[model samples]
Target: MNPLNLPFDSDAMLEGLRPWIECESPTWDAGAVSRMMALAARDLADAGAEVETIPGTGGFGDSLRASFPHPDRGRPGILVSGHMDTVHPVGTLEKLPFRVEDRLAYGPGIMDMKGGNYVMLEAMRQILRAGLQTPLPVTFLFTPDEEVGTPATRGLIEDAARGQRAVLVPEPASADGGAVIGRYAIARFELLTEGRPSHAGWALKDGRSAIAAMARKILEIEAMTTEDCTFSVGVIHAGQWVNCVSSECRAEVLSMAKTQADLDRGVAAMEALQGEADGVAFTVTRGVTRPVWEPGPGTMQLYDLAKGLAADIGFQLGCGSAGGGSDGNFTGAMGVPTLDSIGVRGKGLHTLTEHIEIDSLAERARLAAGLLMNIR
Candidate 1:
C-alpha cells in the first residue's frame, strides 16, 4: 500500500513541527529534554500508544518508550528509533527560528532529528486515523542522549531491541538522499602526553615538548587511515604558554571501520602507541564504542523490504553507511534486522544551516507509515 496515497497535509505536519522546534532539547539540559518528552508522550498517547517515561542516568533527562500493539496481539515487534536531544544548545532558535522559505525548513535539530522524530509521530497519526492494523507490534523509543553517543540510553536501547523482529531508525537521510544500510564501528580515544617543561630562552635544552610528542602520534594515527578504514584527530590541546615548552598535551581521536577485524586492528594499534621521544610519554584511553554495524543477511532483507516501499511512493531509495553512530548501532549489533536514515532528505545536519526539504515530509511519512503497516 502507498502511504503517500493516504491523506498527508504538509501544512498540518508543519503545525506539529513548529512547537517541537520551539522546544529546544539539548542533551545536557534535563529540564528542557524532559519537557520535550512530555509533549511527545501526550501525542503518542493520543495516537493510541502505551507510553512509558524511563528515567535517565546521572540527571540526563528521561527517554520515552511508546508501544502500539497489533490487533492480533503479537509478541515480538518492530522498533522505531529516534532521539529528542540535538547538538544545538538552548536559545539557538532566537538566532535561527523555525522558518520555511524556498521549500526549505530551517531550525535547530530539524533535520539532525526532530524532523525525523516528527515523521514517526505523523506516521502514527495517519495510521491511527485510517484505523489500519499492523501485522506486527511496534515500539518507538525516543532517547535523550543519541547526540552524545547514546551513553545514557545504550543499555535501554539494547534491552528494548531484544527479541524484536526488526529495528528502524528515523535518522536523517544521506547527503545523496539514501537510507542507512550499514554503519561504521565508532572508536573514540583520547591521547594524553606528559613531558618536561623548561624556559624557552634560557633552559630550552632541558625541555621535552609534549606538543612535539603528540604531533608525532597525530601523524602516526592519521597514517592508519585506509580506503576502507577512516581515522581522524578531531580535537587537540597542547601548550598554553608561547615562551615555555608545555608539559602536557591531549587529543581526541575518532576512527571508523566497516568490519570487526579492521576495528580491532585500529584499536590494538592505538592501544600499543607510546611516545617516540625519551622524555615524552603518552597515555591512550579508550572512550565510548559503538560496534560497527555491517549489514547482515537479516538487515539486507529488511532494506529490500523498505526499498520496495519507497518505490511504491514513486522514488528510488539507495543505501549506505555513515561514520557517525546512533542508537541503531546498538540494536543492529544485537542481530536485529536494522534499517536507518529512513527520514526526511535534507542538508547541513549538524550545522547552523541545517534544514529539510519541505516536500520530504509527505513522502517520508508515507514511507515510514508503509514500513510500520507492512513490516510483517
Candidate 2:
C-alpha cells in the first residue's frame, strides 16, 4: 500500500505539458481560454477521465471539471484544482516565442500554470495505468480568469468542492519546492475623487485640487497598515493641464490580508478614510478577488496523511504559505481542506522569461500520482 514506490513515466508528463504552454489563454479574452479548456477536456477524456462543463455564469469564459469516479469502497472523492487561463495575450506567445533550452521550457503561461495542469493530468493517467484506485473518488476542476479573479467561477468551484474530502490545487510548486497550505486574501479597489477646477495661478485658493485630496487619502491609507495587512496605491491618474486645478483624479489600490479579521479591519479603515475627506467628493468600488485560504479544522489531518503518503513513495512533502491567491482560495474559503501548490516547479511566472524546470516536471507528476493513490 506504499504510494511512493508507484511507477511513473516522466516523459509522458512533460509531453502533456508541452502543447498546453504553446497555446495562449489570456484572462481578459474569452475565445482563447475557451479553446484551451475544450482541448484539455478532450485530452483528459482520451486519458480516461469523464469530463463536464459548468456553463459560464455570463462571464467571458467557461469552467471545466474532469472526473475519474472510483468503484472502490470506503473512499471519498478528492478534488484537484487548476486554472486554464494565462496572463499573456493572443500574439504574445509568437512574439516572445516558446522555446525549450536544455532543462528549461520557456514560454508564456508555462510556469504560471499550463505546466501545472499537465502535472495533474499526467498523475491521473499514471494512477489509471497502474490500475490503482483510491478508497474515494478523484476529480479535476479547472477554471478560467484566475489571473484577474474567479469572478464567474468562484461559486462553481465552491459548489463542486463542497462534498470533497480534500482539494489539491496545482498552482505552481513553491519557489523552494514546498506545497502551500495557506494564501493571503486579495482585494482591489478604485478610489475616484472630484473637486472644483479653477486656474491655478489666477485664482489658486478658489479651486480645490482633486489630486491633492487623493494624495492625502493615499497617505492616510498607507499609515493604517500593520504587519498582517498591506495596501498599495499602484496606479494614479489626475490633472489635465499644469495651469488648471485638477477637477477629477482616481487611484487603484491593491490590498492583501492574512486573516478575516485583518481583511475586515482594512476594509473599515478604507471606508473611514474615504469618509474623512469632506472637501472632495469620492466614489469607491471595491472587489474581493479572492479570500485568504485559511486552513480549517481537519486541514492538518489531510496534510499529515499526504506527508505520510509522500514518505511511503520516495519523496518528502513540505507545506508552506503563499502571499498571492489562487482558485484554491475560493474553495478553501468555502470550508474545504484545500492543499495548494501541488504542481510542477516553475520560475518567472507572469513575465516574458517564464520557464518550467524539466527536472521538476517528472518529480511533480510522481508527487501528484502518489497523492492520488493515497487519497481515501
Best by TM-score: 1
Tens digit of per-residue lDDT, candidate 2, span 21-122: 777889888878888888898889988888887655555677788878567422457888888888888888776677778878788888888887888787
Clashes of 2: 4
Of candidate 1, the 10-residue stretch with the lowest lDDT total is 68-77
Q: Each model's C-alpha lDDT?
A: 0.86, 0.79
**Runs in model 2 with CA error above 4 Å?**
1-12, 72-76, 196-216, 235-249, 276-279, 312-315
Model 1 per-residue lDDT tens digits across residues 82-190: 9999888998988778999998999999998988889888898888788777778888999898876777788888988898888989999888778887888888898
**TM-score of candidate 2 relative to the true fold:** 0.86
TM-score of 1: 0.90
For model 2, state the Cα shift of residue 373 in Å: 1.0
